[model samples]
Target chain A: MYERFWRLRGDKTTIIIPGWQSMSYLSDTSNICWFLEAEFAKEVVRLHKVVGNAVTEGRHIVVGTGSSQLILAALYALSSPDAHEPISVVSAAPYYSSYPSMADYQKSGLYKWAGDAESFDKEGPYIELVTSPNNPDGFRRRSMVNRSQGLLIHDLAYYWPQYTPISSPSDHDLTLFTVSKSTGHAGMRIGWALVKDKEVAKKMTKFIELNTIGVSKDSQLRAAKVLKAVSDSCEQENSKNEESFFKYSYKLMAQRWKQLREVVEAGELFTLPQFSPAFCTFFGQEMDPQPAFMWLKCEGDIEDCESFLRGHKVLTRSGKHFGASPKYVRISMLDTDETFIQLIDRLLAIQERE
Target chain B: MYERFWRLRGDKTTIIIPGWQSMSYLSDTSNICWFLEAEFAKEVVRLHKVVGNAVTEGRHIVVGTGSSQLILAALYALSSPDAHEPISVVSAAPYYSSYPSMADYQKSGLYKWAGDAESFDKEGPYIELVTSPNNPDGFRRRSMVNRSQGLLIHDLAYYWPQYTPISSPSDHDLTLFTVSKSTGHAGMRIGWALVKDKEVAKKMTKFIELNTIGVSKDSQLRAAKVLKAVSDSCEQENSKNEESFFKYSYKLMAQRWKQLREVVEAGELFTLPQFSPAFCTFFGQEMDPQPAFMWLKCEGDIEDCESFLRGHKVLTRSGKHFGASPKYVRISMLDTDETFIQLIDRLLAIQERE
Candidate 1:
């Protein structure tokens, strides 16, 4: 998906990690160094502020292997320490699919997975996940539960300008961000949370420490470098053209979404969620639809849309995985150009056959 | 203490991580890639066999963020899935100090910390952690609990030739190893478990997946390179002088132990553990006393060895922290030579004052 952008980046994005870079277990401070580099943390704050997607000031930053790890850490942090019974964890339907497993996998006595927050009428302390520009379906969301006993965790993985308009800086108590979706460096496994409460941040840090003794210093160093490069590119004078990574990514995703929408319209076999043009702060202009995922709902007699796509040699995440109807399928729009082209061709062919 | 070795290594130990390296969450195999790189796993096995320390054949290799993470994973894997109650986790006294916190921090309810296997006379399912060439105090160890219901996980972090004699290949059901202690790359945060049971390996992998997804690819790639370099040096016919990493580490540690012993002998303030000369397969000769930690026992009126050392401007881990007497203090022998020299000077100064 990002081949062209990386081809342009060439050697600038590459980093040499010294064998003895972080040979000692000790970092600057015990808690700080466990999985985070002080420099990397600073860069994360800087990048988020520059993008205007997340509120960094007055927020404690907790780094993780990825947002996936942070998701688990947040759940562990949110759960009551002295509670006799496990708290219920719920998210609305069509949520980020991993929430269920990430919550229940430990079979942790501290928390248990309860379906959709809209129906969660139970009386007790609960954690409700609010994912903005939600996975599977790209829609901005807010927490449905408004109880004093409820805790909210905002997963802002796709809130960056490339994927959505920055309506305002997210000010949730706890919000998750990742370099994978922002800078397209998924392999680095660097994610962070902007936490309002110091106690919660400390507990999350402890969870990370006990879980992995911290994230890899090499990955942290690399993330710092990549994030810096991204910030620099965004701030460049000639950034409007192909030189800026943000502009380049935005253009690619927008173009793909347009082409995909066109093919789906021509086929008339599927319909896409409608997204209106919104003014983006970073771009300083009205932006087109650029969702990370394409939620395609099959029309007519087609059922089990994921299996239907799979039969056409185009693999997609089933809506059932996201606790939705089987008629809907989630296709990744962030894949390589070649993959995108193949997917379009397959969808067009299937449409013709139908 | 290993500064000389690192200085000799210089830039050869550095690795350059490309921005686009291993971007996809997916690996060669879904589970395999999450926990390990096939090549890195192969190198780990090869290096252990070359050093004649761990038996790798017919074993399932599971990688972790660090041996620390694996320690928890092993405990989780060893616990019964169907059991209504949490399993008891026990280790011998003066065990790795992190064992207690690591086991209980999650409050998983899957397992609970039970102190000292020798004193654990419980009649229930239990998991015993046996650290051979144990932490704090270096001594060869075995599982004290011989019951069929008891499961053993051997932590062989210090079983390398530099720390102890590799008398023979260790063939345990579950063995943990790390590049940090063996190659002095603690920052890499890469650890592996050689498991005899496939089911346990799968569970360990699942725990890692649920925890941090998997170990860092960049760290794994770097470890593979370092292990290969270490193995190459060990096999070199001309590595007899000081080129060999193992020989260099052993000689430096052996010399430090000898010098420290002489100073302690003169002071009569503290005493070190005694270990008989043991045959080392790697060196093809009897090895001298070379342990990772100096287990110092204070003599006379020194009530707390740690506090006594602290007064001399030398910091040491208290024996009370390791569930041992306050008269004992554990000092790291793995620091820089300058630090080690300063520690020795302080000890001598305290002795002179006494």
Candidate 2:
């Protein structure tokens, strides 16, 4: 497909050739988000002066869109899909929903999920995702778990400054990061992964070149600028009210946890009494128990409850979207304290009216 | 891959997915460039307003990159490649060089130029590019051409107000327009096509979605703005020294052409004895064509000539890049008067030294 692209684009093309592109020796700024080798080197060098030398010390940095969905897509494209050797992707249950879509792009020419690595026959498997400090639970990989083999895509999109100090790299595992959480730039649509290997980096680069033509250059620049600013600000913590940001972030989350706890204590809710993090989930058990969802064990039409919640101007995901039982709905703690309170108050009113 | 992305994305994802996206109602901005069936009605309305009301008379007023390259590629992707059909790609020789590339993308590939429609073995060709009031040379199709089979990609990239006063559309052709020449914003990279077939339009949309993840919204906006500015400027042309700009443009081109014409007329030089009116070329016949690339062609060692041009603070593409005779060269009149003069003087000096 790209061969045709190169042919028609003409030899007048100054930036790229049929099979290779020369490193930009002479800087041309027609595009700010080129993300080509030079732009990558230029940006890393320009930012490293401010980020310090840790960036050069084998940090696995993965970059992508608001969801890390693009990152996953990149991973699939970079892997060996055409080899006669069989390969499959594997992830733990209750994984982020977009994984199937990422894997589907490969489609194995015959099967969906292509026998996810966990289910892959011993003869062949390709990639595995191990979420360290996992989402919805913040559960670190148990130190004794002998998980190995296949490429491991470690997502750490949410493990930014507030979850863990940036000054310390979590030895828990190599991970992904995004500004959506750490810098309140979710609207910015930027994400990156920090991989500890060079071959992985080359493969990822090739995949990205094939997809989306790389991220918006303007967005990347503004994002990199903002990131540097944040890293700088975090470094100069001696300033007045410097530590307050994380404190406020924690306080905001803790307040919502307290509301759910109160509801549980009042017999309006029941914790599955599972081993999970205080921050990762808010659960209540019914006949069908899922450890992560915001369970509403009530006698009512699931659709009707969803409509009722919408009517109250509070929004959340339907459990059905996740292919879960209709009796449950999931409420994430991403909302502000005020919105959370409004939601809780509305829920209490629903019960009172019933 | 996305499963890892989701699993690793830390849990603070408090984003409100746009209700329109969930309901799938709002027009996806990404689909705006390609005309999908779902988007055809909206596009027809838009096409009626922007391109011409005549576009709404049928289902195809498609948009693409600034050079119509998008539509050319689109038609190729939709066509069958291995069919035992008499499918042939027919276009005039000295055609838009990109025409063959477009056909190859479809895999029916480029058939040899059979000169005219009477000889064109057009029983089953998928795509044909018929540029009228053709580019380079302003030769509009003179009506003997047959358009019964095969999709036509009209790269009338240069048929505009300033060039041909009598230009008009053929009865059947997929017409294209580019802002690069029409508005002098090649760098903006915006092109639009009026595809007459709805199914073809729909297929193009799908291919584009796979190709580059939609055109640059920012670049599109800039092109629109510049075009509007040019339009407004045109409205006030009589009072705004409109004649002066044309005179300047012509003067600039003519000055460069004079030096070039004189060199060729001197009999010591050889060039396209007759070439496109849009450009003026000169080749070294007796005067050692130091580097064969006096135009985009170079008789000299390609790499060495490129080095020479770079050292001399000049730049010209080589013919090999254009699928033209290796020693042939092409030059552009798309520069300001000063630059054109500089080029002319430089050429003269090189000639004198030879």
Per-residue lDDT of candidate 2, residues B1-354 (tens digit) = 011211222132112221111111122445434322232234324422332212345545554444544544444444554454424555654454454443432122213333334356545554565666554333555434455555566665554433333222233546666655554544334566666766666655544434333444433433344444334333445686543222233343444555666755554323433333322111111111111112433333443444455556667554443344545544565555466678767756665665
lDDT of 1 by residue, A284-333 (tens): 88886578999999898889898888888989888999989999988899
* Candidate 1 CAPRI classification by DockQ: medium
Write down the TM-score for model 2.
0.57
Q: Give the per-residue lDDT digits (tens) of candidate 1, residues B217-319.
A: 8788888888987887788838555467888888788889988998999978889999888898888999874889999999999898888788878899999
C-alpha lDDT values of all predictions? 0.84, 0.43
Candidate 2 residue lDDT tens string, A173-228: 23455545554544335556555665665555444433332443333444555454
RMSD of each: 2.3, 13.1
List, for all models, the DockQ compared with the true complex.
Answer: 0.61, 0.06
CAPRI-wise, candidate 2 is incorrect
